[model samples]
Target: MPITLPNGITAIELADDYPALQIETADCSATLALNGAHLTHWQPSHTAHPVIYLSPTAILQQGKAIRGGVPLCWPWFNAHPTDPDSHPSHGVARIERWDLISATVEDGSAIIELELKASPVIEAHVPFPFQLKALFNLGQTCSIVLETTNLAKENIAVGGALHSYFSLSHIDNATVTGLQHTPYLDTAARPEKSAVQTEGELRFQAETDRIYYGSDLPARIHDAEWKRSIVVEKAGSLTSVVWNPWIEKAASLGDLPDADYQRFLCIEAANARHDTRILAPGSTHRLETRFIVENLS
Candidate 1:
């Protein structure tokens, strides 16, 4: 039987790639892959530029993480904490298939929910057993709700991030506002560097990677080239990750183009570092991020 989607929403299969959903509405248009429930494209009709950044050289094949857009990093983040030598980067969520639970259009916005159940592959990555559910609301703004539930009998710790790659008119034209006065760990440094507080809005010059601690405040990306700003708001998250691969790192990534570093900025909403949560059996934790694009002109 075919799944019936609400008005302006259609189920789509990506040729030889993953099965996904195509959302079209009066205010915006977007594409979401069921593989990881990854949101690859989202562009509002009023804006000339895309809201999400996708790599031109990204390989859309199976079992590989897509190079851009919003990739979910769950269970664990970055490299494996203890098994970094052998485990995968960012866990197995991005490479797994998710089932569509429901789809409905509410008050002009399209809300789609999807679920990822535990499996042998997920079990192989983490010691604890758990499940995940994600909800996407596409409208004047984009909101993602991620809920994680613990299934084991004992308490377990977890951390991860939304890991959003936002499109930019040009890398130099973007500066992130907020996260100032908050402590952060610079991950790009050799031994890693720690700062007591971020001074002001962040600007790009070189490769940047920092994990901010204890900040739940909203952040905004001021895009001078496009004459617009993107507001990032989060709930149930304490850590913020701001990163830019710059020239050298971008060149080394097979999925990202050499000079393409000039095109995007990643300011993630996360639960990482000291903010990792401990969940008891039968308990569920929710993390959400809301993105709004404002035209400056």
Candidate 2:
């Protein structure tokens, strides 16, 4: 059954038979859904068409909807670099079903807690015994807090990220500020050298993927066409992943249509190859990030 949380946030209940969870916020009338705990939709209003398209067809059956907002791709983090046992690319938690343990509203924000336990399906991919909780608060500002507690007796190396696919009116009309004079990994460069170059504002041109490390600067995404700016504030997680699949790679991911690539950008907080945290037995680690939206016109 779907229950109405405090501050007028409604949460759709999850049944063991299905893999769907819905969170609706009153402030912006934003609705977010999780299909098998993978991001299904995150848009402001129902009448407003998704800025990003999840499927090529309409009427997505069996919990498959048009995912047009931020998708939280967590767990094993990214590709393990030819390592078979280092967890799959982007982890197993994306498809794993997370449980909703508690829901509360505080300070005009709706906080919903979700947990993932050691299940048969999850154990097949990630054999670690652990308890993970993701607290999602949606309101004046959207925030997600991920807390993981190890249940096993031994230590475990953990790597993960909250993949947020932010939609834009147009790729060419947007720019990412606050990254001036920062060192970044030039993915296009062979052998991937780290160099410090002063690039004023991020632009979409060619296949770009870089991990900006040791930076706590607030990443702000501005869409000139839409006249909107999304300011990202972070804590616990230091690195940010900025990428746009562009034209070529977009055609490769057959699941995504060609035009969809021009409508969205992936800005994620990730713990990838460079920096990884190893949590000890009975130890817990927390990562937090906030997204504040504003009209810049």
| Per-model lDDT | 0.87, 0.65
Candidate 2 achieves a global lDDT of 0.65
Off by over 4 Å in 2: 1-21, 34-68, 81-87, 106-108, 188-190
Candidate 1: which stretches are off by over 4 Å? none
Relative to the unseen true structure, what is the Cα RMSD of model 2? 3.9
Residue pairs with colliding backbones in model 2 are none
Per-candidate TM vs. native?
0.96, 0.83
Q: For residues 152-176, what per-residue lDDT tens digits would candidate 2 score against the true structure?
A: 8898777777777777788898899
lDDT of 1 by residue, 1-297 (tens): 456898889988864767889989887889899888899998877788899999988767666888898988887788877888767787778878888999888876789999988788777887788879999998889999889999899998878889899999899889988887998898999999998565687888999999988888699998998999889999889999998999999989989989999999998889886778899998999989989999987
- Pick the TM-score winner: 1
Error of 2 at 255 (Å): 1.7
